[model samples]
Target: MDPTHADLERFCAELKAMWEACGPPVLTSVEKYGGPKKSQVSTILNGDITTVPDIDNVAAILKACLANARAKGLEPPANAEFDYWKGRLGSLTRARSNHSEPGPAGNPWRDLAGTHPVWESTTDREFFRPRVVKAAAHLFDRRRRAATVLAGDDWLDETLAQRMTDRMGDLLTGRLASPAIRFGGVEASLIVLAPLLHQVRVAESAAALIGVRPIELRPSASAGPLRSDYERFLAGSEQSRLVARTELTGVPGRTGAKNEIGWWLFHQWVMRRQDPVPTATAPHDLPIAEEPLRTVLAGTLDRLVKLFHLSPDGLRNKERRNLVHKVSHPSITPALQDVRELLVGLLLVTAHKLAVELTALPSTIVEHLGIPNPVDLGRLRALLTGMTWQPLEVIGIGLYAQCHHEAVLEALLAHVRQTDAVLGSVRDVATDRVHLEPLLRLPPRASADFVTPAPHPDNHTRPAFVVPVTRFRIDETRVRELLMGEQLYSDRSLAIRELYQNALDACRYKQARHRYRAALEDT
Candidate 1:
């Protein structure tokens, strides 16, 4: 082996034994004048949960590994990107650019690579390995999976150590029939401590155990993944909100709107499933529609078909068109089309499966109500005006009260104005709107990040609420609630100010260019 590579290899093996300390920081000797004199990955993380890594213990080990690798005449990674054991690490680099008619070289990572050299604390969610959790209990649940510390002041007696090893087996592995193996103290401890113990077990397995007391455990010092953003993302708390902001800035394609086309594409890219198979089949009685909307599915689908090129699948303008497209339907009224297609498209596309589920229900619910269709209601009322048998009046009132028909709602609102019992109609209609109903928003939902109610598409809900997809705009307020928080207004992803800036810049650029050409002609 090459001596450099061999030394690095040896250093990597030896550094694993030294759990804690700055012995592994590769660039530590390079020396900085301000801020953190020595910057590694975890130290850069501070306390943000979103940026922690899955295996934090590897910080020191990775540091040592990098140093040894670099000392052996290997190059520093061109910034943070590298591949190890088929796994890739996201890297950010800072370096000086080439000579460009100047004495001073500029930082290449900042100037050319479009990144800042000074590392900042990250905010990312973390995912824990459930298997590691299971394995911790697997190894330690016996005899409460106790750790035996040496009692002696120094290294303790070797014979005592050997005997202690036997005692550990007896404690953990011995068959205990007496006292029914009372788990009084440790049972609750297990519930609270099981997860922590598992982390410890995982640490121990890597030959990177951090010491633990009976009640407390500290994180192991081993290797620095050196990418706090990614690490914290994996190690952060699970209690994070459904809507989260990441340290990552800028939209993927163009101007970095949170709603930017590029960001939207990236969202879609991450949610795409390479495999076509589903985890389970849908329900037989799946209600694809909600109340008044369920009552109007066919009528609505009829109007939208030519506009959407609608078949079974939802909207079909183009896959990547903006949510509220400027294109107008030739046949429909523009205002209705705007609300029906734009707002409704936003609503349905967001909760499309719910819309589909709402619309999927049979149109016969209108007929089942024993009332004439809105198309025929005027004539029906005229015929019923002079008729006898007041019982029909009772049936009519009951049906009107139950149905979510807009005409019914309008009539009832009128009736309520005349006499307030009709407010019951509005309240009943609005209150009962939330009853669980299946509506097919999308057959195979293309985006995992699309906002919808919880309890999953695979799961079922109750009696059809038959809600309009537009009614679902109530949920967008929730998105607004997340975005308009005190700390989040400045987030570029959520900010609208940049959009104003883009418009202003375009106007200024055009005016300035015109003036520059005019000056050139005069000269």
Candidate 2:
């Protein structure tokens, strides 16, 4: 007896259930009873094949299961089970035979329309509404299925699940367009229409969000189609003038000369122009009252006194004398006292120079003078007191701004010359010592105490010294000619195309080789 589709489906279901319940023995073990391989077994159980399995194969599977059960020390099913399956198979065969009877010929019109008789009788609205509703329901079901597959074994909390649902709703309602919906539109339509609708919804939502109002298709006149003659004249005049200027100034017999001409015109008309008033030198003198000057001087003196106790005895001390000498004669020795004194003397000199140059001493210089670390207040005061006469004279000259103060100028010049002479001597000594230090160091001994030993001569036969054989000298010019010569192809373009083709072929060959190698490894 043959089995019907329902009988095959039921039997497959029952067989799958039994296989699942028994710990699902491997296909290899089941094959001993003439059962198919695992893939064939899966196809049969899944009812994926058009035809049903033979009764003999079905019986073989039952026997295999019984064998497996007994081997596992489990009780085998009674003969009743076999009887039941046999009866079911027989019934299915009878039903299939009865159902196989030829039916009325199918109507070609109905077949062409792909509709049933009931559908043909109903109105369009009645037929479509249920389909639309069913399609919508199916779309939602598909989304749920997709979400489930994506979720896998992950425990999605309520909040996350709610968010996902909301996002899906947004996608469906055209509020959010996702890439999946856009690119997978056609594919998703076959499954369900939600994805395509999602993309449309998203686009609509975006357009709405952006407040893109629909514009009239017809062209509208701007500003009542009026033209400003003055503006037109100005624009035309400027364009003509630009063209004339380019033609007039452009270099003769040169390509791209207009750009150069424009640049030249710009430089002459704008960049080369000068301002009437000079900006470099501005008068900085502020006409303040004599009282402000006195006040500033008095404050400066008081701070200096407090900063460095400026007593007459402290000025004439041995430490102050040594400080003056250190400033006059800079040394290479890292003596902390000498460095501190020298820095203090230089600070005082710089302050005097600033007082002469600037109308008011800058606060920054004053701050530096206030620091009393290695050089204490007393030492700074002593150094300042020693130079007090020179600064006063220099200040007077600077303030009077008269050319007849040559005496004072000469004295200052003489002092600078002396300082320069001392610096020159120090520089010469440093240069000579730095340049000669390595050369002056004691040389290494050449005798037994330091000399390197030489290798002893061997008494064995010496290997013959062989000169290298030169086969060829590369002709670089010829090589370049071979690569670049027009003779290689009918034209330069063809040559380039040929080179490109060779490169492409090489790349393809390499890719194929790599792919083959990878396939071999996989196998």
Best by lDDT: 2
lDDT of 2 by residue, 135-223 (tens): 33432333333323222111111112112223223223331132222211111111122222222222222222121111111123431
Among all windows of 10 consecutive residues in model 2, the one with the lowest summed lDDT is 442-451
**What TM value does model 2 have?**
0.19
TM-score of each: 0.15, 0.19
For every candidate, C-alpha RMSD to the true structure in Å:
31.9, 44.1
- Superposed by TM-score, candidate 1 places the C-alpha of residue 228 at a distance from the truth, in angstroms, of 47
Report backbone clashes per prediction: 52, 3
Clashes of 2: 3
Q: Model 1 over residues 269-344: C-alpha lDDT tens digits?
A: 2222243212111111113223322223223322322222122322323343223322332322122211223322
What is the C-alpha local distance difference test score of each model? 0.25, 0.32
Instruction: Show the colliding residue pairs in model 2.
Output: 2-93, 174-201, 174-202
